[model samples]
Target: MLAIRLVTAPERPDALVLPIRPTGNAEGDGPRATLESSLPAVADELLAEAAALVPAARATGRAGEVHVHLRPGRTPGRLLLAGVGEADERGWRAAGAALARSAADETHVTVAVPGGAPAASVRGLVEGLLLASYRFRLRAADEAPTLTGVDVVVTDPAAYDEAVEAAVVTARMTRLARDLTNTPSSVKNPQWFAEQVEAAAAGEPDLHLRVRQPDELAAEGFGGILAVGGGSASGPRLVELDWRPVGARTHVVLVGKGITFDTGGISIKPRDAMKLMRKDMAGAAAVVAATLGAAALRLPVRVTTLTPLAENMVSGSAFRPGDVVRHYGGVTSETTNSDAEGRLVLADALAYAVADLKPDLLIDLATLTGANAIALGTRTGALYSENDQLAADLLAAIDAAGEAAWRMPLPADYVQYLRSDIADLYSAPTQGAGSVVAALYLREFTGDLRQRWLHVDMSAPSWAERDDAELSRGATGWGVRGLLRWLATLA
Candidate 1:
């Protein structure tokens, strides 16, 4: 865990981190100048050394670049140079993450927070730091002790304090999502996930949480979730998280697809590909974290997160292809491919959210379709909504959060893609339009809602193959930042 606080300056910290702007980008001014003015002797040595390095050796002040030095007589002894390419949210966050990675061996560090930028930038920096520092080594043979108690030096106290708290909350929740996603499905099943959430909300006064097991779910006619989880021994669970504050004008409900371990059900994924299936629950983890985050930050919006959890394994009892299951709201969906199970589980939760909860706005995130990755690649997520304004708002949030998202159209004629002779809806057209058809299928359940709905496909971004920029090796926590920004925009 990361322990961060705002302080005037470092009192001999283990490391002194300075956010370095390129010679031109800094306009020859900023924190580096401030540090130089504070200690010209140290500045003389640092500049000379920086200048002596070859192009390949120079830290360049580009995003993801770092230069470390051990200054024998300097104030902090160890000095770190963090590159800030453009000083934007992405740059700042990446630089902060790079710096945090550099701090792995050291516990106490003094970080010079960027000045003059808005609170959003400050928040972004802290978000990166925590995300980079996150490591799920619980199952590792040996784990390194991590950094704790960061001493932040900032120009403005009030802005720093306000941004820091929200940033800290968002960062922790994001890391929580990453942790939940990175965990192997063998140890982290649906029941364990609920127990963790229950533990987290144990003492939080504003949060009300309920985890509905199989018997209760079957009693309530949650056939989709019940069927998708019918194969695994772990069974199925519907995790409902709520944060309701009186006098709230706006209400938002988030539905997430939670397949704890998907062997593609009766269809069955290849053995080699199932290794990363543990991250299929990234959407559920994200929505849960975002809901808890909103409650922690005390946002004025009333939020509810419905996560339909399950393990889609192949068994004699597993739901099979060509089977028709009636979901919540009496919406029957034909399972054309058992691999298309994510949308099946999501259908029940979305219907329940709309029919029973009736929120003003509804958003669902899922690792729903491989076509999403084919269409948008690993760096970008795909979002679909018939409501123009809501789509625009969420895209703006994606931009503001320095994440990637592209809005895909909901063709008026696309309903034909999901036509099913056996049921009200089929999973897909079977060949092309996997992403589009999945969203269109969800539109069936959300048809009667009084307000707008947005569906996000996180199939690619949530489980990336390699580390890039701010995202670590696994469980990038793709939706948390953008969703948080979107919620705050509504607030």
Candidate 2:
């Protein structure tokens, strides 16, 4: 975790990061007027010197742009001009990330807060700084991160206290999600994943955790989960985390696909695709982390997180295509493609949530198909919901959280694609909109609760090929922030 705190002024900082915005001039040049006027006398001088060091053509104050000036004998040896395009929340977030990346070797740096910045911008900046600084790797002790603390220099330190605090918790939880998703499959089997979640909940007084082992899973009707895990020696488990506060008005149940490592079962993925299969459990990581965030924030709404853990590996006992498996609520799905196993495990959890928990809102997150990436690209997720209000509200929260997602239509006409002759539905359709078919198939398990349910196909967004803004290079922890933001609205 990064030590982020607000201070009245910089006290002999090793480096100074001054936020700058475009002046809207023809050349798209330097700092905004408010930034220059707000900085202290010393910082004002440093900004001028920094501007002289870098040409205006090179540093146009565009988002995530940085200009550096080295001071020979100054108390702060380095002066960085961080660009916040238009100085909005998104811009501030980009600037914050750029600052963290630029000063990766520094122990501490002072960020000059733009005067009269709103609480949203403060939160965005802090979230970006902390999130972008996240490092996850298995390395020698000598190769640890160098950057440790950030000091935000503000006029009144107490003004943005709440915003800073909230961003800290949100960023930390997102990092937790990333840590879970990035763990290698060799060490992150079904049992190990459940243990990590249990340990996380152990510290929370309001959070209750229950794990259903293989026997318990079989005793209860979780054929879908069992079918997916039959191939792996690690077996399967179902984890339930309940956070119910006194006088909560709404209950939101979150189901996540927890395939610890997906080898595509009998239908094996190519070598390239299987390399990153460790992150197939990204959805489960997100929901589990978000539920913990809700508890940390003390949100007034109740949240129950259900994660079905399994490893889809090829073996003699692996489930095959044409195999009809009965899910938790007696709904059966004929497996059409063994590779499409995420929706199978998710189906059991969703059915269980609807049948027993009866939550007011049901949302499932999964890396269900590559079609979602083909439709919306790698950065954006596809959202499908039966209720317009729920869709609108979730989209709003996603936007405010600075995440990208487009709500796709759940065409009733597309329901025909999921028809299975041998069972209630087909786990994977032979032909159609791959993501749409996947969403519609899961909707079958919801029964009459479809109206309250929303499906997020975040397969692409959950893993990043490279770092961008607040997202790291590995498991991006995509849905956690937006879900937490939506929960806060309900609270």
Candidate 3:
């Protein structure tokens, strides 16, 4: 719950954060100049102290290095030097994140924005602070060294007004997603997930939300979701969230796989394998959080989200191997492995979204396969697109937002593994390239599978596995920033 504001020179801070550039970087000079003027006026003494205290520069401004000076009189407490090796958007955010982490014990701080910084870079800086300030202590509010507020000192306040606003929405949504994802599955099942989305949309004028229950899904021929969620006591839900500004020019539909818990259903995972299943719904969480954020920011694009919420569990009534389910659009699919249930639920949502919503571009996010993780690892995500331009656009979004993602081939030849003798398609392939085959399976149920569609196989489950990347050790809210930036680029 960090509060951030763009300000002038009047605000006194607990600590002053200055971005440090490497010796050889061209952009390092301005920041160095700003630091010199902001600090005490003894240059020779300061340089001696810095040489001893700061980390050795490996490259020209290596990222994530921190140097601290205690009780610099110009500031209230200490001076924090954060590294931004080359001063790109990614580096700026890394600097901000690094600064936030260095000042984690402090409640309030002021950061100096370098002279002649771009407005977009300022937004990234703010986002870094806000995101790094996140903690997952839902009940331990008193124990955590949480950041309460931040003041960003900028040379051009007028240029950053809108950028700050966007940062606010992005940061708030990122926290919201983390809060939802960090909550255990005991309290965050499919029904509860749907209710949460409904509650969030309560008073927003530009946002509309609807939740469809198990019976409704069955009646509507969404057998994939219905079957996958049949074993859970909590049942399943299809949560539709739509955000429409009055004069929006384009439509974007987002579908997220909301597998509340992945026990591998009847195909049951080993005890060790089932540990992190609570985070399996992160894709759906991203969609819910991002769409609500769009309404708050009032972006001039119509965004719709179809989140299929379900719990893949084991029971006498659970869907079994070789069971045929009739998905939306009247397409029948056979379940070869119940563990591969994410694609099943996504199948129904994707078809429903594209056919009924008729969006300009269709995107679905799912922690759908382990093969994707094997292909790309936990630090990066896998993105598959049938259209070349859409792939390129999403890659640009990944770079600008500083979220890691790599394009994976959908290779039409991989479609053969999904062929079924009993049904139109099979949920899991018989053999290799499981990630690619999973994407091919989802594309089969989508309307216009080869055009205007993008699929993000977030196999890493959208939570932080390490202490780096300015993210705390919980749900990273990976898609919120990139989706917002991509939506803003529309028109």
Candidate 4:
């Protein structure tokens, strides 16, 4: 984890020298000379002296590169030139990420943005840098390299404080989620996943955690979870974590699909796509991370987290497409496609959350369908919900958190798409309204609880090569911020 500290405006030391580029025809010497002229008065005549020592190349003002050199008479660090391409937010953010990545080994690094830049933009840049620089190299038994801390020096302290603080919290939560998702399946099975919930809730005075392992799930009639894991060597578990604040009027239930490793059972996935199956548990990771964030922040609402952890693997005992399974709430579903097991487990978990916990709202997240990726492309996920108001609130939350989410319809006319002639329902429809059908299947488990419910099909670019300021190339930690923002609105 990266520790972030702000350098107070009044307490900033004279030793610090920030690099800058010339605005117009002021270009004379190299980047070092230009940066020397831009230094504050507290830093002495070292800036002026350094201007005369460097070569005669002009500074480009790009966002990432840095050139620093010492002057003749100074004892402190040399003048440093930082890129500030076009003085725009995107440029600044990219530059900030590059700076963090370069300085990951340094004990303390400080970033100085010009006075006129938007505080939000600067903070966003810092946030992006911290997130992008995070590398999961824990598996190597040798030297464990980690970033200890960072100090951000902004011109206006007050305007950027709130955003910076929020970013810190978000970063911590994101890292937590990433670490869990990155853990190998052998070490992070369904039981271990349940143990993590218990451990996260151990010190919380108001939190309660419940775990239903394979035996317990079977006793509780969670056949969906049972059937999905019946063939796996590790089995399955349902984890429920509840946080209730005194006098809290609203209650929200969060359900996450935790398929630890998906080998696609009888109906196998392509070898190319199977490589990324480790991250199929991303939805579960997001919900767990969001719950932890809420507890850490002490949000004033009742929140229940339901995560069904399982591994879908191929074996002689694996459930086939023609098999019928009974889920929680007595809903029987026919397995139309064994690969569509995420929805099945989520159905059991969601049913338990709505029927037993009876929260005021329910939100289930899953990397349930590739069709969502086809519909929303790489940036945004598809959202479907029965309650428009709940959907609108979640969209607002996503917007506020700067995560992309789009509302997809749950047309009642499409309800028949999932109908099974022999069973109460089909795990997947024969036709290809894939994302919507998955949402519709979950809706059946929600019952008539009068609570607002949302289903998020996160089949979009959970991992990609083109990185953004806030999102890394892998396991975007997509729903953490959005979930936190929604909880804040409840507060």
Candidate 5:
């Protein structure tokens, strides 16, 4: 974690980041002059030097554009002109990410905050700065350099205190999700994942945890979970974390697919696809992390997070294709494709949540299908729900949290694809709209609460192909921020 301090003025830090707005937004002649007037007299020369480099670097003060100026003997020796387009939250977030990446070597840095910056913009900047600096590596000696601290130079630090604190909590929780997702399968089995959740819930006020083992799962009739985890020696786990605050008005239940390692079970995947199966439980990581974030923030809403953990591996005991397994709510599902195991485990949890938790809003996150990636690409998550208002609220939360999610349809026509003669539902429907059919299958488990459910198929967005704004090279921790934001709105 990087240390962020809000300071009224710069104290000659190692690096100084200046927020540069678009051409028309800057005051006092131009961007450089405007920044110069805001800073002390010692920064005049450095600002001029940085301004000259901006055009050479082709930086038009657009978001995510950064121009660096290094002065050997000058005060605040290094300067970074980070673009905050239109001085908006999204713009500030992009600029913060760019700065974090560009100043990776700096130990301590200072940022000259834009004048009259709103709380949202401040929050976005802090989140982007911290999230972009996230790194996960398994190596000896740990020789790589990292950003240590940041000083946000502001006119009135008190005004943005709450915003900064909230940003820190959100970023830390998102990074927790990233850490869990990036861990290797060798060390991260279902039992280990459950233990991690239990450890995280420790010492947190009003947060309760329950971990159900294989025998308990079998006794309670979790056929889907047992069938899926029976192949792995480590077995399966159902982790339930509940945070009930005083006077909470709404109950939101979150279910995540926690396949710690997916070898595609009896139906094996290609070598290329199996390599990244360690991150198949990214959805579980997000929900667990978001639940912790809510507890840390002490949001006035009851949140129950359920993660069904398993390792879909190949073995003699692995559930075979054409096998019909009963879910928690007694909904039978025929295993058409063992690779579609996420929806199966998710069905058990969603059914249990609907039958028992009785939440006002139900949301499930999963890396369920490849078709989601094909439809929305790697940056955006495919959101499916029948409820219009819930969809609208979640979309708004995603926008506010600077995450990308597009609402997909739950077409009644496509529901036919999930029909199975031998079972209540087909695990994987061999139809086009693979993502839609996957969502429809999960909806069957929601019982009468289907209208209150929102399904997030985040297979692609869960893992990043490359580093970008607020995202590292591996697990992106996609849904945590948006889910936290949505919880805040409900609170």
Candidate 6:
């Protein structure tokens, strides 16, 4: 974990200065200097020189850049010149990201942005940068270097401290979620995964943690979970984390599909596609991470997280496509495709949560289908919900968080696609409405307890190479912020 610190502008001495010089233009009229003049003064000559060189540092045409300056007899050990491109919020954010990346390997670093920068905008920029530079290195043998501490110097210390503190906490939670998602299945199987959740909730007075192993799952009539996980040597487990604020007004139930690794079972997936199956549990990671963040922030409502953790692998004892499995709530499903198993595990978890915990709202997340990726591409997840208001709230939350999500209709007619000849329903529909079918299948398990429920299909956006402001190349923690924001708005 990185250590963060904030330094006030008055603390920096006058001996340090950042002279901004514009690049791509002639002598006296450079945009860099024009922008720099709008910022607070630096404390050292070397810092001033580096600040002046930012405009000419790079020609990416995107935003600002940062230059490092080290000078003797200065108040601090090193100085950073941050470019304020066009003096806009986006420019400041970009510059902050660049600075964060530059200092990722350092123990401590200071960012000197102009005091005139908006308190909200500066905090947003810093938060965005920290999010973009996060990576999961748990599987690596060598210790990866990371930024330990950051000091953001601002002119109006009292004005920006609250917002900055909020941003820092949010950023830390987002990174924690990303780290869990980015960890490979080899190190994060069902048992280990549940252990991590336990550790996160160890000392929280308001939070309670419980784990259901294979035997306990069977004892509790979680047939769907048992059926899907019976094939893997690693087995299956259910994790339930609850945080209840005293006399809370509203309760939110979150369900995540924790497939530690997926080999596609009998209806196997192609080799190329199977390589990324380690991220199959990204949705679960998001839910756990969001729960931890919400609890840490001490949200006013009660929150419960139910994760069905398992591994989908091929073996002699693995469940087959034609197997008929009984589920919680006395519902039975015939497995049409073993690859479409996330929904099965989630069905049991969701049923247990809705029937047992009885929250006001339920939100289930899974990387359940590739058809969702085909529809939304690699940037957005597909959203389906019975409650229109809940759907709208989630969409607005995603928009505010700057993540992509498209609301999908739950056509009542699609229920016919999942009808099984021998059993009550089929796990996967013969018709090609893959994502919708998966959601519909889970809806059956919810029974008559129809609280506001949402199903997010995050198959495509889990991993990709496209660059963005708040996300990097792989294992994007897409739902962390949106979930947090939504929880913040609940009754």
Best TM-score goes to which candidate? 2
The TM-score that candidate 2 achieves is 0.96
Clashes of each: 0, 0, 2, 1, 0, 11
TM-score of 3: 0.92
Score candidate 5 by TM-score against the native: 0.95
Which lDDT tens digits does candidate 3 get at residues 1-491?
Answer: 67777776527656766666665434543322113233332234544544444443332355666676786455446767777666676877887788778888877887777666778777777788878877776574558566678888876688899888988788899888878888899898998898889888899988988899888998888999999999888899999999989998899999998999999999999998798888889899898898998888878899999999999999988999899999998999989999999999999999998778888899998888888778887767899997889988887887788888899888867788788999999899778888889899998977664499999988584878766666889788878777877887784
Q: Tens-digit lDDT track for model 6 on 1-491? A: 45545666534332222323345454445452433554454535544455454555542234545565565665555555555455454565566566666555556666555666677666666776677667655454856566656666667777887766666767787777677777877787899899889888899989998899899888889998887788887879999988888888898889988999999988888999898888889888888988888887778889899999989888888889999988877778899989988988988888787778887888988888999988889889999888888899999987666578999978899989888889999999878888887888888877655547889998888776754656766788778878987888873
Tens-digit lDDT track of model 1 for 1-491 = 67777765456566877665555423433322212123222345654553444133444577767788786876567777777666677777887788777778887887766455666666767877887777767654766666775776766667678788888888888888998999988798899999988987777777899899999999988999999999989989999999887767899999998999889988888988787999989999999999888888888899999999999998889999999999987889888888999988999998898878989999999999888889998888999988899999999988877678999977768788787898988875674788987888888888666249999999898965666666778788888988888888888
TM-score of each: 0.91, 0.96, 0.92, 0.84, 0.95, 0.86
2 or 4: which has the higher TM-score? Answer: 2
Those runs of model 3 whose alpha carbons end farther than 4 Å from true positions after fitting are 25-60, 72-76, 138-146
Higher-ranked by lDDT: 3 or 4: 3
Mark the regions of model 1 whose C-alpha exceeds 4 Å error after superposition.
Answer: 23-59, 114-117
Count steric clashes of candidate 5.
0
How far residue 295's Cα lies from its native spot in candidate 4, in Å, is 1.0
Name the regions of candidate 5 deviating beyond 4 angstroms. 24-58
Candidate 6 TM-score versus the reference? 0.86
Candidate number that wins on lDDT, 2 or 4: 2
Candidate ranking under TM-score, highest first, comes to 2, 5, 3, 1, 6, 4
Model 6 C-alpha lDDT versus the unseen true structure: 0.75
Worst 10 residues of 6 by lDDT: 12-21
Model 5, 5-77: lDDT tens digits are 9888787577888766566534444443223235442356666776677656556677887877777896777
Q: Least accurate stretch of 10 residues (summed lDDT) in model 2?
A: 28-37
Query: Model 1 residue 62 lDDT?
Result: 73
Model 5: per-residue Cα lDDT at residue 173: 96
